[model samples]
Target: MVASSILSPAIADSLYAQSPFHSDQHDARTGKFWMTSHPTEPGDNGVVPLMKHWGGEVASMWVRDTELLAPLREIGRPRIIEIAVPLATTPDSYSAAKAVVATFGRSIGAIPGKGAFDLYTNQALPPSAVLAIHTEGDPTFVAMGRTYPTGFVDVDAGRWKELTGEDD
Candidate 1:
């Protein structure tokens, strides 16, 4: 089924401006950031899932609902939903991931070659819970989900390759 709701870029940015999440350089990429929620105390875990139900896509290997809130203190939670926000048609993967953090929220991962990533919040268009952004346009189209865990894994390229059976 298609997503029923979507946010525009302006609204997405506004919401992020009002939230408490913070961004930091990812360990893998020097200039790339990993926007994350402060898990000082338990607040609400429903926000991510609710966004997914509203049209976010499940977009990151590191984004788990269980660990989303307390990222620093934990890891591995049920995969959370993420909204994909378009940044550019030709920007590098790092630029796109940075945009997701600065504009939408922490990026779970960047869309392969698409100038987009799975943003935790503040996404303009709600993508299918099970789809990826198919084409870039107003009310973007979505197709069956395709997992793209880019920049985040580059830091541990060796480990990732061993685990995923990739050859250098």
Candidate 2:
């Protein structure tokens, strides 16, 4: 089934801006800021599904849930930025993943059903981007094609903790 609620870029950006943990960097390659955040509190444990927002269109990964901490442990606490694009209408389901590949003209990585959100990128991402897909359901089912950002910058864990008062 398709998502009944679609978030506008302005609303998304406003919500993102409200978070002190949110940050973005100017991407010379795309000429737009790539945003990321550490949106969870320390000791927060739960399954975070994968979601994608391209331009203005939003899509949820077929997989329902994934470990939230896996990516942080694997990627060394990089700024978890939101992926935003100009605007486009893309179908949901596997087509969402395909749309990302088509937009970037390259193969994208897929986070397995039981996998953590651990994908990272060393390059600048296209306007279309991925985020933790938040949803409710069983966490043990097989996942369809799901993609995440291929580029991300690492952040200092100690400094982040100091700033946010989050104890590890």
Candidate 3:
């Protein structure tokens, strides 16, 4: 995935091993599940958004839907790759921040944590913008000069153009 900071291959491997998907909470105060009261007990499971099978489906959907992306290897069912990227000054560029999320944001099961690619700023996105790439593991590729993914950053699209000397 595209990262805001350059990352070592070893580090991405460890993160993948720990917990790939990121998570968050949504307030449904009027609904059936809400953390209305503070403390009846400590180990309480609240009404939280949930995602299952973070990486597996990410891999599968990348295989199933897009010709743009494919598994780095023929053997591995699940894998994680890290790419070094430039500073995505605009937020929409956040999409470019991570490759896995870029390749399969939809087909993958519920996003991990806030979900896949949650580990980024608002505009951080992949596609269209220029980026430097680095990868470890099986070696997945993202097209920097081609069409962007459906969710690639729009938040910073205008700003990015302004900074890069494009018509805003």
Give lDDT: candidate 3, residue 166: 75
lDDT of 2: 0.31
Best by lDDT: 1
Per-residue CA lDDT of model 3 for 33-136, tens digit only, reads 11111111111132111111123322222233232222223222322223223344323344444544533543464232212232222243455433333222
How far off is model 2, as Cα RMSD? 17.2
Per-model TM against the reference:
0.20, 0.18, 0.17
Top-TM-score structure, candidate number? 1
RMSD to true structure for each model, in Å: 15.7, 17.2, 20.7
Off by over 4 Å in 1: 1-77, 88-94, 97-123, 129-155, 159-168
- For lDDT, candidate 2 versus 3, the one ahead is 2
Q: Which digits, one per residue and each the tens of the lDDT, describe model 1 over residues 1-168?
A: 113224445434444443333333233333332232211111134334422332222222234443232321222222332333344422345755554454332245433222333223223343453333222221222211222322232222254455567876
lDDT of 2 by residue, 1-168 (tens): 113234445444543454323323223212333222223321233223222222211222221223322221332222233444323422222444544444344234332222113232344555456534332231211121222222321223244465568876
